[model samples]
Target: RGPQSQFTRAGVPAGFRSHPGSTHLNYMINFWSDRTPLHEAAFQGRLLHLRALIAQGFHVDTVTMDGVTPLHEACLGGRYACAKFLLDNGANAMAVSTDGATPLFNSCSSGSAACLKLILQHSASIHTTYQLASPIHEAAKKDHRECLELLLSRGAQIDLELPDVGTPLYSACMARAAACVEVLLYSGADVQIGCGPDSPLHAAVLGGGADVVHLLLDFGADGCRRNAEAKTPLDLSKPNSSVRAALLSRGPCSLSQLCRLRIRRSLGKSRLHRASSLFVPHSIKDFLLYQ
Candidate 1:
């Protein structure tokens, strides 16, 4: 029975296995509607109490009725210490809650860069698909710039588009997460890879984020691009609104801006960060890298 210990539960997730070839000892979990003290301790970031509970035989992988482990609670609460302790004690980092959210997603939702990094260290790869709500998408939508950057640095796809959520850039625009939009754009996310036909500029206009709309234009997002309803970003803007003003003022892509876009395209997404290494003036390198 190695790491598989049977525990009857009401809402256990589909997968309940431990890390393959793990050396840490796994304990059998007890489940009930009231849940375990580990969940409480982890959610509150009570490291001393969590340590005591684990020492007293509380399973590190113990879950609730919704398949939420203490690790999920810890990440959700931004409790890096408790989360670290759980992972060290054989807790599953990839455990999904009833809502299809992993601890990594929870960390993003909580805006905890530390917890996100800790969970990423435990997990092997980023979730490229829309599964588990996409930690990258969560970070972008929640305006957690640090968490989003960490995911991107760890190879999370920048332009990952979901059926409903669009790309991370679009989601950021829709959520009015201006900083995230800028970060995604800077990180080489496609401005055109929006949700279905709706572009990030369209989303920004509809969401009333003037700053975000401007950033999209600066990044070469096509304001004339129409959505499913045949409405351009300008068309989506409200009458007498700053969004409309920004979109209208952008007019055409400037010569300098076009050159910047062209250069970045030639550099490609993988090498965008390496632009600084190019033997050029500091200002030229900064301009190329969007620094």
Candidate 2:
């Protein structure tokens, strides 16, 4: 027999298929009818029920047909208590769903910074990529600045390049996430990193990110940088737009700015954060830290 017959044998109420046109009802039916009790508990954020199920010997890592474990559901929903319970019961933080999203990816995509921190403390790999996009890429694309910062502080690669989406900076620009773009830039992301017929500047222009365009220029982005189509970002900008004007007005970096950039680069990306604490004039410190 097929799955329907099996459900019948398992005492499922008859007429489950009676509402074929009711997608929402069918979804509810699937949620309750198909998911194991443990999976349902986590998805519903029922902390006490989850604990009881764990005490009754249900597996903490139980997954659905799509390979989404209980912990994945908890994190995806931003259920702190449910996630904490699941983690304490030995749920696997690294389990990937059928679509390649891990719990960390779900947490980042959902903008759950607390859940993200928990997963990171559990040794979730910041380098893990889902469809060629890392956790930071997911956070950046979704405009999850807190999650992005958490990932970066945990040693995520600032320049992680995706197959089609390019770098986290590009993703931030495409999403018009100004704060995320600032964090990535201060972390030493390459402002000129190319993304197909677009650099970060082009991505900002395409996303109508005038503020982001200004920020990029302030960080010494090359306005004249061309893409595969041989069109500079200025060429793609809208006529009479501030972004266009910003790009057009950009010029060569002065010697002082160049010296600051060189010193920051020589200090290494990880060590550049220390420049803020150095004993120097506040202006010099700002230049050193890319303020």
Candidate 3:
């Protein structure tokens, strides 16, 4: 029987079409109504229904309402059987959703080891970017340590920087996923690369992860690195006395280095300040200085 007829037989709500006007709703219905059956069968570790879908010429490449393919959902849901069936039926394992996310991305994002293994078997790109973040970054952000290990074992790039200019280690530091940060560091991720206005150390300080900051320091992350606003990670920590104390506990040299860097930055700022004053009227400058 067709997927529509099967849903009707299974007492699905009427007017529920496999293809809907709204992409999000259609994606959900495609899974819950038609694709969900296959997913459930796969989760039960059954292949009979999957085989039937293949026989019925069901396109394994079919996209749901949100442009997510069945493979994407199957991998995210950890339906190994369904994923295998789709792969066997010529489903493109590397197919990206509307958001440029692949099944591998979904698996990592969901922290599904089974799904990750199946997708990796098909050679999913370990470096694919999704919504400005890589799968490794997403896994690290979520503290999916197991998934991080699995991806690394499969040759995932430990230092893969996303489009937003952040690495997996940076995301882990930002999310305060200490274990994940450790894994990435051991795997050879660079701790010094700045993402936007903060390096991993800065992110760790900003996120209140003193342990991660210490870990980064042990890994040789430069504490004196100034961000775009000329604020060192130390300066960013002043608002939180606890974080400041933690940063201070690292020792005097680090603090001195940070202070010197900040002083140099301030000198540069003063130069710019003096240059801008040249353009201002003397009267206005006197008034501003007095104020």
TM-score of each: 0.86, 0.83, 0.67
lDDT of 3 by residue, 156-239 (tens): 777666656587888899899999998876555666875865688888888888888887876567778888788888988966
- Once fitted onto the true fold, the runs of candidate 1 whose alpha carbons sit more than 4 angstroms away are 1-31, 128-132
Model 2: pairs clashing at backbone N, Cα or C within 3 Å: none
Query: lDDT of each prediction vs. the true structure?
Result: 0.82, 0.78, 0.68
Best by lDDT: 1
User: lDDT order of candidates, best first?
Assistant: 1, 2, 3
lDDT at position 194, candidate 1:
90
Task: Write the residue-wise lDDT of candidate 1 on 183-232 in tens digits.
Answer: 99998888888999998888898889999988988889987898999988
Could you tell me how far off, in angstroms, the CA of residue 19 lies in candidate 3 after the best superposition?
18
Off by over 4 Å in 3: 1-57, 129-133, 238-241, 252-291
**lDDT string, candidate 2, 1-291, tens digits:** 013213357333232332655422122334433456566677678988888767755567765556778898888888878998888878898998778888898899889999998998898898874655368888987889999999888888888777687999999998899999998988888888847657898899888889999988877777887887898888888999887877777688888878876787787778877888888899999878765
Query: For residue 172, what is the lDDT in candidate 2?
Result: 92
